[model samples]
Target: MTEENFLLSRVKRFVGSLAHCRLLGVTVVSAEPNSLCLELPYSEAIVGNPDTGVIHGGAITTLMDTACGSVVICALEDFELCPTLDLRVDYMRPARPGEPVQARAHLFRQTQSILFARCEAVQGERTVAHCSATFMRIGKDASPKAYRDYITSGTAMENS
Candidate 1:
C-alpha cells in the first residue's frame, strides 16, 4: 500500500475496534497525515427522540472527540496515548432525523506534551456541531500495548 493508504488503513482498524466505536458503529471514512473523518451510522440504538429519530447529542460528541484523537494518531510520528484535557463543542443544529453523521477533525497544533484540534460534525448538507479539543500527550510506553500491536501486526486478538 502507499504510505497514505497504509496509515489510513491502520488508523481505521485501530479506531474502529475501540469498545465505544464498536458499540456506536463508528467507522473511519478517511484519514491523512493530520486529519481524519469518521462516520456514525444512524440507528435506533442511538436515537434520542423516538418520535423524531434524532441522534443523541452525546453520540455526536463522541464522534467529534474520536475524530480528533484519531487525527492525533495520524499526526504523530509514533503512536502514543493522548487523553482529552478538554473538549468544547458548539451545536449548530440537530442532525437530520434519519441520516448518518460524519465528523472531520484537523490537528491545529502539536507540542511536546499537548495537541490541539478542531472538528465539525455534519449530516449531508447540514451542520450538526463543531468541537475544539485539547489532549495531553502521554508518552508512547504509557499506553496499553494491545492497540499498538494490533496496528503493527495487522492481526486481531481476543481481549483478555
Candidate 2:
C-alpha cells in the first residue's frame, strides 16, 4: 500500500482502540498529511462543575494530546511511535454541556527530533480551548514490537 494509505489506516485503528476515547464519543472526522480533526460528543459525566456543567479540563487535554499525536503519525507516514514531550492548554471559555466539540490540530513544523503542533477545540463558532504541544519521535529501534509486527504483517496497530 502507498504510504498515505498506510498512515490513514493506522490512524483509524488507533482511534478505535481508545476505550476512554470511545466513551467520550470521539471520532476521526478527517486526516491528511500533518493535520487531523476530531469530534467529541458532550457527556454529563465529564462535567467538572455540576452547577454550570462545564466539561473537565482533563477531558479537553486528552483530546488535544490525541490530536497532536495523530498529527505526528500522519506527517511521518509511518507506524512509528511518538510520545508527547510537552503540552500546554489554555481555556478561553467553558465548554457547556450538551454540545459537541470539534478539535483541529495543525503541525506547525518539525526540526530534528521534535514535532510542534497546535490544536483548538471549538463548539460551533466559539472557541473552547487552545493547546500547543511537542512530540518526540521514537526511533525505529525504540518502537514497540507490536507496532513493528503490525507493519510487517500489513495490519495497522490497534493501540498501545
Candidate 3:
C-alpha cells in the first residue's frame, strides 16, 4: 500500500479506539503527506444551541485539533505524542443540524519541536469555521504506556 494510505489507516484505527472522544463513527476520508480530511457525524449531544441547532465551538475546536495532530502524525510516520500549543478558530457560519461536517487540515510547516497547521470545517460548499494551530512534538518515547498499548493494538487490527 502507499504511504498515505498506510498512515490514514493507522489514524482511523487510533481514533476509533479513543473511547473518551466518542470517535467510533468518525471516518478519515482522505490523507496525503500534509493534509487530512475527516467526517464528523451529527449528534444531539454535541449541539451547542438547541434553538439554533448548531454544534458547539468546543466541538469544532476538537475537530480541528485532531485533524492537525493527524497531519503531523502522518508526516512523521510514527505515533508520537503531540500536544496542541495554541489554536485559534474563526467561525464563519453556523453548522447545520443533521449534516455531517467535513474537516480538512493541512500541515503548513514544521521544525524540530513544533508543527503548524491550518484547518477548515465545511458542509458541502459552505465554510463553517477556520482554524490555525501549533503543536509541540514530544519525544518518540515520551508517550504513556496506555496510549502506546492502545495505538499498537489498534494498528495490529487495522493491518489485519
Candidate 4:
C-alpha cells in the first residue's frame, strides 16, 4: 500500500480498538503523515441538555481529545503510546442537535519524548470548539500491546 493508505489503515485500526472512540461514534475521515480528521456523528445519547437539544460539552471534549491522541500514531515513525500530558478545550458554543461534529488534529511539534497537537471541533462551517494538547511518548515496548498489535501488523480486530 502507499504511505497515505498505510498510515490511514493504521490510524483506523488504532481508533477502532479504543472503546471510548466507539462509544462516541468516532470515525476517521482522512489521515496524512502529520494530520488527521475524525468525525463524531450526533446521537441523542450525547445530548447533555435534553430540553435544549445541545450536544454535551463532554462529548465534544472527548472528540477533541481523541482527535489529538490519534494523530500521534501518524506523527511517529514507529507506533508508540503517547498519553495526553495536557489538553485544554475552549468551548465556543454547543454543537447543534442532530449535526455531526468533525475534529481535525495536526501534529505541529515533537521532541524525543513529547508531541504537541491542536484541534478544532466543527459542525459545518462554524467552529464549536478548539484545543491545544501535549502527549508524552512511550516507545512501543512500554505501550499497550493490544493497541500496538491492532495498529500494526495484519490482525486488527474488526469489531474491537
Candidate 5:
C-alpha cells in the first residue's frame, strides 16, 4: 500500500473496533494526512431536548473528539494507541433535528509525545460546535499485541 492508503487503513481499523463510536453511528467521511472528517447521524435515542428535538451536546462532543484523535493517528508516521489528554468543546448552536452532524478535525501541532488538534462540527452551513484537544502519543513499544492485532484484523475484515 502507498503511504496514504496505509494511513487510512490504520484509521479504519482503529475506528471499526471502537464500540462507542459504532454505537454513536459515526461514519468516516474522509481521511488524509493531518486531517479527518466524520459524521454522526441523527437518532431519537441521542436527543437531549425532546421539545426542541436537538441532539445531545455530549454526542457532538464525542464526534469531535473521535475525529480529533483519528486526525492525530493519521498525522503520525506509524500507528500507536493515543488517548485524549484534554478536550474542550464550545457549542455555538444546537444541532438541527433530522440532520446529520459532520465533524472535521485538523492536526495543528505535534511534539515528541503530544499532539494538538482542532475540530468543528457542522450541520448544513451552520457551525454547531467547535473543539480543541490534546493527546498523548504513546510509543509503539507500549502498545499491546492484542490491540495491534485487532487493528490489523479489523482492517482485513473491512476489505473483505
Candidate 6:
C-alpha cells in the first residue's frame, strides 16, 4: 500500500475503536498523512430543534473536533496522548434534516509538543461549520498496549 493508503487504514481503524465515535456513528470516509474525512449519519438522536428538525450545534462541534484530533494522529509518526489545548468552532449554517454531515480536517502545523488543525463540516454542498484546534502532544506513556496497536486491532475486528 502507498503511504496515504496506510495512513487511511490506520485512521479508519483508530476512529472505529473509539466508543464516542461509535456512539456518534462517525466513520472514516478518507484519510491521509495530514488529513482525514469523516461522516456522521443523520439520526433523531442528534437533532436539537424539534420544530426545525435541525441537528444540534454540539454534535457538529464534536464531529469537527474529533476530525481534528484524528488528523493529528495521522500527522504523527507514532501514537502519542495528544489532548486538546483549544478548540474553536464557527457555525455557518444549520445542517439540513435527514442529510448526513461530512467533516474534513487538515493538519496545518506540527511541532515536538503541539499540533494545529482545521476542519470543516459540510452537508452536500452547503458548509455547516468550521473549526480550528490546537493539541498538546504529551509523550507516549502507555505501558502495555500502544494506541496504534489497539487501533490497528480494530481493523481485525472489522474483518471478523
Q: What is the per-residue lDDT of model 3 for residues 1-160, given as tens digits with 9 covering 90 to 100?
A: 4777777776776666656456425678888788899888888878999898888978887787778877786677567878889999999988988898888999999888999999999999999999999999887689765565556445233333
lDDT of 6 by residue, 1-160 (tens): 4877878877877777678889989998988878889999999999999999999999998899889988977888876658899999999988999999999999999988889999999987899999999999877664124454666443233233
Model 1 over residues 1-160: C-alpha lDDT tens digits? 3767877987887786689999998998888888888999998888989888888899999899899888987888777878999999999999987789999899999999999999999887778899999999989889667767677556665584
Segments of candidate 1 deviating more than 4 angstroms:
155-159
Which predicted model would earn the best lDDT? Answer: 4
- Model 5 global lDDT (CA atoms, 0 to 1): 0.84
Predicted candidate 4 versus true structure: per-residue lDDT over 1-160, tens digit per residue: 4887888998888888789889878999998998999999999989999899998999888989999998988888788878889999999888889899999999999999889999999988999999999999777889656657677764745554
State each model's CA lDDT, in order: 0.87, 0.80, 0.79, 0.88, 0.84, 0.85
- Each candidate's root-mean-square deviation in Å? 1.7, 3.0, 3.4, 2.4, 3.2, 3.1
Estimate the lDDT of model 4.
0.88
Clashing pairs in 3: none
TM-score for each model: 0.92, 0.85, 0.86, 0.92, 0.89, 0.90
Clashes of 5: 0
Q: Candidate 2 residues 95-132, lDDT tens each?
A: 87888888899999987688999999999889999999
Question: On a 0 to 1 TM-score scale, where does candidate 2 land against the true structure?
Answer: 0.85
Clashing pairs for model 5 are: none
Give the runs in model 3 whose Cα sits over 4 Å from its true position: 144-160
Error of 6 at 148 (Å): 3.1
Q: Which ten residues in a row have the lowest lDDT in candidate 2?
A: 151-160
Tell me the deviation in Å of residue 123 in model 6.
1.2
Using lDDT, rank the candidates from best to worst: 4, 1, 6, 5, 2, 3
Where is the poorest 10-residue window by lDDT in model 6?
151-160
**Reference-based lDDT, residue 132, model 1:** 99
lDDT of 6 at 99: 92
